[model samples]
Target: MYDIVIVGAGPAGATLARLIGSKYKVLLIDKRDMENENPKKIKNKCCGGLLAPDAQKMIAQLGLGIPKDILVNPQLFAVRTLDLNNNLERLYQRFYFNMDRDKFDQWLISIIPNEVDKRLNAYFKSFTEISGGYEISYIYNGQEILAKTKIIVGADGASSKIRKLIAEDISSPEKYISIQEWYECTEYTPYFTAIFDEEISDFYSWVIPKDNYLLLGSALRPREDTWNKYNLLKAKLIKLGFTFENKFKTEGAYINRPKRGSQLYGGKDNIALVGEAAGAISPSSAEGISYALKSSLYLAQSLEEGIDGFLDRYNQRIKGIRLNLLIKNLKSPAMYNPFLRQLAMKSGLQSIR
Candidate 1:
């Protein structure tokens, strides 16, 4: 039996595996064949692919530096905040990194020790309680596979199967269907921009420029009107002097935004949940990489203490990070409220001159 089984190989799962894979008999499972599978055919993450300051701090705490190859062209210096409702625009200084999100995830997976059993193109189904641990069942290569693990970790994203088994007592945070589209460009856009239009979404939308493409993405409520709002956003940006060229790719994914600390579901029994699986994401900004990295680090430290009573330790350690996420919820209203956002932009508070 393996000592631990980690579900999902995104930032949280990959980081967790990298940290404790050497110490434990670990099985790392991921649905995507990131290495072999053609990215165009698969549903990739719908992210702006920009690393925020909080994520940078977590990377530093882990004593690791991002490789230069993972970075994208035109390193950003400022964010142009657009108030579509009031015709106000302001530039805010930024230290965020523009990188290839897929490559970054692959790099994290690459660092994992060879001792860990890395399983790709594996779809997790369910788990059941057993004598010493849990019996995990998954579908891999057109066959149902079963395994035993003393401890299980759900590092999956917002719609986590493992979390469903454990966190029934807590309701999931607000769920938003994030949609992003890539457009080919003749020239590179110089700055990253954030657009606020309550008519489009209550959360936010972003325009980030990569090498020869521009990424436009938004977090919107999942409803029949979702695409209508997205199309409207594109139309709005066109009026704001942003040129749209031939469309290349589009991606959609589920992202959970928690408004309170109580919404974060850690885990129970020998199972532990980390990253967006536990709702450890920002309600204000919908930023998750920082929380994903921090939660995995906290889980790794807890596992280091010993598998016995590890759940309590993991949950206890997660409290601090959850508290921080809760605080972000407090700040969300100022940005989401159109009147307040216009006031802040007009006052030029914290906006770089």
Candidate 2:
């Protein structure tokens, strides 16, 4: 029996496991094997991999250390926004890190103590409510193992099995599908750039600079035709003075709107959800690494403080942030519009102060 059984070993699961490993018996399960660094093994995620300024603070609070090699000092010189005609409009905000998702996940998992049992290549089979809590069944190396636990956490990505099993009543809002391609540039740029296209109304392309590569991707609108958004964006990049020497990889995923309520703590009993499973990604930027880290820390804190107190504090802390972003999104739908995205970018730059 485990105190908490966390499904999925991404940023959220790994972080939570590390935080609670010392005091509680935690079982972290993932479909992938231990040290599985291949992005293609699972669904390739489309992300800029930009960590916000507050990410470091949250990481330290969780008592986890980031590995040195995975860190890229993307001292952002400027963020340039271009119109449909490739006209530069705004440039602001400097300094942010560019991280490789696989490397980042590896580093996060490395900090966890051995006491926390890590079950790799374990596919969650099903669950049933036991007398006190629940019994989770999974297949590991073709054998089934039933682990009884008092608490279960769904740190799984957007499509969470634990969430489906537990939060059957909770609903997820419409999701925006996004596509990304990582290109190894022949020449490196000093700044990060976002190009807005009037055609792709709700979507935008981003070029994040790393040591010797550029992370480029497009966030597609819900109903829009995604037929050739990647190729279109690649062509646009070439137009914007980016020479793509090698196409390293491409990935895509769905991002839920920010207005969706917390999908973390569900049921009146002992089940909890964190990270994308809980819909923690920011709707505006579709960035989730920071939120995953932050939410895991908060979940750990809540566990330490007892259930009731944790619920109250977690709701209070996250409600305002979600509400504010949702309201902002509703008031200015064009904030996502290509033409008006520059203004939104400018606003973000101003808020950095």
**Prediction 1 TM-score vs. true:** 0.97
Pairs that collide in candidate 2 are 76-95, 264-273
lDDT of 2 by residue, 1-353 (tens): 88889998888899889888998888999886646767456543456777666666667776656677887745565666666633436666655666766677767778888899998878988889998778999998899999999888888877777767767777774467777666776475777787777665454678787767777777777556675666777776687667776878777777655565553343335777777777777666566776788777777877887644455566556564466456545654555554555566546555333
Model 1 — which ten-residue stretch has the worst lDDT? Answer: 34-43
Q: Tell me, by lDDT, which candidate is best.
A: 1
Q: Number of clashing residue pairs in every model?
A: 0, 2
Per-residue lDDT of 1-353 in model 1, one digit per residue for the tens?
99999999999999999999989999999998866647664446678889999999999999889999999987998999998888899999887899999888878988889999988889999999999999999999899999999999999899999988888877888899999999998676778999998899888899999988999999999985999999999998898678878999888899999977888888888998999999998888888999999999999999898999888988889989878987887888789888888888899988888
For candidate 2, the lDDT comes to: 0.71
TM-score of each: 0.97, 0.84
**lDDT, residue 83, model 2:** 61
lDDT of 1 at 226: 99
